[model samples]
Target: MLRSDDLQVFVLTAELGSLSAAARQLELSPAVASAALKRLEAQLGCRLLVRSTRSLRLTGEGELYLPHARSALQSLVEGQQLLAGGKATISGTLQLSAPSDFGRNVLLPWLDEFQLQHPLLSLRLLLADRNADLFRQPVDIALRYGQPEDSSLVAVPVAAANRRVLCASPGYLAANGSPRTLADLVHHNCLRFMLAGRVHERWCFLDDRHRELEQLVSGDRVSDDADVVRRWALAGRGVVYKSWLDIAQDVQSGRLVVLLPELLGEPTPLNLICAHRAHLGERVRLLREHLVERCQRLIQLAPFAH
Candidate 1:
């Protein structure tokens, strides 16, 4: 039998052209990855790869064995999925990625509940504001905001009612007074956040006449982390434009107050993105549905949830 690690090391080394890169992707040291490949070749009694400092190329045996190894791996994964499919209890690691704020505030507890329900299942979550490369990264699932840029990925809508909401803490509002109009925001402290690498100073909204409005608002404070921005808002630092799901509890509990009630924020989608549709197990599909259903309920419960 081809050991899973050996098979993976061979496939990844061939695909990535660098033993170090494949090793890092698998969270194994370069020494271990090299040893695994050597073990595989020793067992097969053939040289599969020609390696040098600059490059790694597959030999004739590797060229022939590559497809079969990949196919075999796929088969094993599918068979495991089939065995676990629709079972009352499901088991296996579910690797997921999400935005930092959403992952910490919203998805963390939700995942906890999921974990409790399926004790056999394991979870690996990576939280970052930037989108993960599904092909290179080990993540099997990701939750994100807005349109998925990668055309190759399959995006499932977790919720369509996602709209930005302008909020400020009660103390800040008391000190700075609520803005009565879009023009009024310029005078107020409008907190800014950075996504990826760009600073998001421009905010979009619909005016009372149902016309689109965009403003490049500035503030005394800025942060790369959305959670930091939210915390600042909660601390009465400044007004922030953010998704309703993020500040639902704050809005409901009166920690933050929604401003400019008549103006509607632009729509953004909350999506469940995956690399491809093939071999997606029933567990993944169920989890998608579960998120959508729960998010819908949360939107319903949130006082001013878009």
Candidate 2:
């Protein structure tokens, strides 16, 4: 029979991808963690990992053993929770990552409510526009905009937010005149968010038939920050294509106006992603459900929720 301690260490090592990380998590020395893994492998008569100075890769045997180890650990945790009964409350740290703007305006407020309900749960939230690697980082969950392409992590659709919209200040529109069609945008000063390294300045639009139209919209001013783009539009610099949520307040305040609203497209789905563990704990389930519920409420009241 596989020892439960050995199984726990195996699962930790697999999840963390390093002996030192697993050791830190388990509160064991690296040497002890390595010894435990060696012993576990020796007992099973199979090598588990291909270790290098910079990286660790699971071998065929290691991959096969991973699911079993995770299952054993999850079963143990569930059994403990069952034994604890009503006292089995979630009381651990949950690390989350999200875009800076969404984190500030949307996630933080909902998190405040979630915290009030679950006072025992501690949270570590990181706000960034860049993609976070859950396998490399110590984050438990990440809220990502748009659909995720990574198959390694499990992604759950939490909310749907409107996509990029083309808009400008009323003053700018009065001077440049409003674009009547998609082709008219090319002749106008289009502010674009250049995702740091991309060469092309392409903008996508949806026609009345719902067909996608990709155009090379040009402008002298370009930035990656949505706030900066909004500011530029407010200053009457040029037309900007940005997320509706980022510009909704400005639009409502009349600091900016949606130009060519007929050309805008459908919204993108917001996803909450996490590493694929064998089983999800009650805390994760509860938090995920809460976020989904909150997002639904927001969608109903959202200005662009058409």
Q: CA RMSD for every model?
A: 5.8, 4.9
lDDT of 1: 0.82
lDDT tens readout by residue for model 2, 1-306: 668777777777876788789889899998888888888999999988878789987888887667556546656765677788933466556778987667775678888998888787789898876778765455667887776678877877777665667788999999999888878888888876655455336778777688998877888887765456667888999987766656656677788887777675456677878766543566667788898887676555444555
What candidate 2 gets wrong by more than 4 Å, as runs, is: 1-79, 86-89, 169-178, 225-237, 249-256, 277-280, 301-304
Q: After superposition, how far is residue 256 of candidate 2 from its true place, in Å?
A: 4.1
> Residue pairs in steric clash, candidate 1?
none
What root-mean-square deviation over C-alphas does model 2 reach? 4.9
Question: In model 1, which runs have C-alpha deviations exceeding 4 angstroms?
Answer: 1-88, 302-306
Give lDDT tens digits, candidate 1, residues 197-261. Answer: 79999899987688999988999998888888999999999999988888877888899998986
> For candidate 2, what is the TM-score?
0.68
Error of 1 at 252 (Å): 1.1
